[model samples]
Target: MKIIVDRFISDSESTISHISVDQRFVCFGLEDEFRAIKVLKETRIPAGTYKVALRTRGKHHQQYIERFKDIQHEGMLEVLEVPGFTDILIHCGNTHTDTEGCLLVGTSAHTDPENMSVSSSSIAYRKLYPLVVGAAKNGSLSITLEDNDR
Candidate 1:
């Protein structure tokens, strides 16, 4: 499986890393717009087609352990599954003003010293995560982000 994120298109100063495998696509924590953490044995994901899955615990994610009780009951911290139509992703932003509900990268625009203001974790989640997750889950061998420089 291959995962790609474009920094130019991302909100500045985001930290992305740590990808995990569930039942479908490889899941990851979004570090930055240009960085993606993919789960595979190889250092680089081969360019091809593959499927994707998103492992989300839901809105009560802070109560993650209780949210996905079954997974947690089994002693697992992260929940794994295809995102389906939901735009849940381990992305940038915090639980405050910066997040707008999606996973965050920087604490917030004010917190990030680099002055990255255009990217929204929620927006990025809406625009990018689904497409990548969809491709990965549907059996697309390779996942690519064109880096639109948004």
Candidate 2:
């Protein structure tokens, strides 16, 4: 499966993106700000294609299992070989604050009263997880992150 993230919004606090699979719209994504000088948990992953897989065991996997007990999945989706980054998983969250240099999936993007960007995270994640798992059944999944700002 080939997933594409088109990052159209680049701001000081976060980047909002639209995600698609094989030309089909899937979800919105929220990531931390893009900075010339990268800061831990405050910088978005570089735009590039990365191999993705479902990890059955790891800190993220365990955490997801704990958080979403009703979701019948064995592992979390992991973006592999991200240069200078580790443990980058495409998981659930609403805002940039919820991510630590990882991708957050959401159904829709909105600006809150506090002026922070957020999304309908859990619903989108639940919708995404199964599609990814189904795709992985055929073969390895890959994602291409494109910076539209450029």
Candidate 3:
């Protein structure tokens, strides 16, 4: 399955996760886990195909490699050559700037951009958590910046 995570909606972003399961590709919304019913978000990577790669930062490095290995081992999704090297993968961030060079997903259990006591309540988790969880469960998600009414 060639899963495409398109972000072409208004006021939010979207993410598509492909999990390796018994030599098969399972593309779904990461947000589905939380029973989220909405899709799409602000700031998208435009309409184009890009190669997916793993960009690990810290301790999760091992987990990131495992994910890529699983994908290749199962023959589910193959990495492609994207112009300008726009690599996308699971990373940590709370806002648009957090994305930096890659797709910024939910925040980590330890690091919350805000100093607030409630980490989960942070903007990152509150907005991205539900969306990603839903995507993972649904097997495909698109994020857009355009209003539905428009």
Q: What local distance difference test score does each model get?
A: 0.34, 0.81, 0.32
Top candidate on TM-score is: 2
Show the lowest summed lDDT stretch of 10 residues, model 1: 40-49
Residue-wise C-alpha lDDT for candidate 2, range 111-135, written one tens digit per residue: 4423446467888887777777767
lDDT of 3 by residue, 3-49 (tens): 33322122223233322222333222221111124223323343354
Q: Rank the candidates by TM-score, best first.
A: 2, 3, 1
Candidates arranged by lDDT, highest first: 2, 1, 3
Q: Which residue ranges in model 1 land beyond 4 Å of their true spot? A: 6-52, 56-89, 92-118, 139-150
Worst 10 residues of 3 by lDDT: 26-35
- Write down the TM-score of every candidate: 0.30, 0.87, 0.33
**Global lDDT for candidate 3?**
0.32
Residue 10 of model 2, lDDT score? 63
Cα lDDT tens digits, model 1, 9-101, are 334443332222222433233333322453221112222223344444455344534533443321211112323212333444442334322
| Model 1 Cα RMSD, 1 decimal | 11.3
Q: How many clashes show up per model?
A: 25, 0, 38
Which one is best on lDDT?
2
Better of 2 and 3 by TM-score: 2
The candidate, 1 or 2, that scores higher on lDDT is 2
**Clashes, model 3:** 38
